[model samples]
Target: MNTWRQTSPTGRALLVTVLLTGLTTFMFLPLLAVHLSSEGVPAGRVGFLVGLLAFCSQGFSLLCGLVVDRFGTRAVLASGFGLRIAGYALLGAGTASATAVAGIAAIGIGGSLLGLAVKTRLVAEDGVPARDMLALRSTFVNIGVIAGPALGALVYPLGFGWILAACILSHLLLAIRLTLRPA
Candidate 1:
């Protein structure tokens, strides 16, 4: 039962990370629907594809703690950013290929790593009480969750690629912030 608030710099980063993760999924949901719709993937398969992505992303989270321990947060975080970028691109291009599914998996995998990495970084930085950090972390994550669906609904009508592009920018912003901040 750890607790933290998005009032400090590290806390702000945590919020950003949660938002990135939430946005990543939110950005993909409708896009996936649209992408599949255009590809004639069959309406029935649409649910299956989205389910597959969620399943894979959730699975990745299960192993992220171990991965973060072995690789260090910096590497894991950077890779997470890179994966998101690549995942979105692959997904967007997946309009004509199977790579979109792979892209979703990649995003899921990166998200798991990012989730764990942020937690580890926060603890390492003494961001909050160990007893309440998890709750706080989840709170921010849920905020993203709440926002993502709305964002998807808003963007889904326009185009899925734009949502993916926005996600890329989010990652880039995190990367740049990480680079400029003293390690």
Candidate 2:
């Protein structure tokens, strides 16, 4: 166990997790509306797709909380990012509604699991002073929420496909960061 007696693993993990969360948020939410719009999906349908992410993520969060202890953070993080990669690929291809929904659900599940793993590991490693870790993580998530939409808007001018590619790069970076640090 990497104790938090000296340099706080919780704080460090929180910082990294925040960045990862930002990347994750950037991966899906920001591009969702734009992606759907580009596909000529009805605005109402776009709204439903966006809403599905939150609903699906809620369920996934519950499941992730249950299994995170056994799976470990590394595995969860890797798998989550992998799902995001697949989700982006499917979205980029403009798959059928059923296929897109399945992919979105996968994204929600993977993202939630990754989040739980990060939180659990930070709590375990940081111990009592986990508040700072939690706060930092929350802040990062908020930042992601703010940045994602703005980033999404840029996709129109640059190219919709570029958004998917960028997300893939972000996920790769996230995986690298988690693997190198092992926390």
lDDT of 2 by residue, 63-166 (tens): 78657667777788778878877777777777579877877777777678777877776666524556655665677788777777677676647777786777
> Highest TM-score, which number?
1
lDDT of each: 0.73, 0.70
lDDT of 1: 0.73
RMSD of each: 3.0, 3.8
What is the number of residue pairs that collide in model 2? 0
After superposing candidate 2, which stretches have Cα over 4 Å from the reference?
1-14, 23-31, 180-183
Q: Stretches of candidate 1 above 4 Å error?
A: 1-8, 43-48
TM-score of 1: 0.83
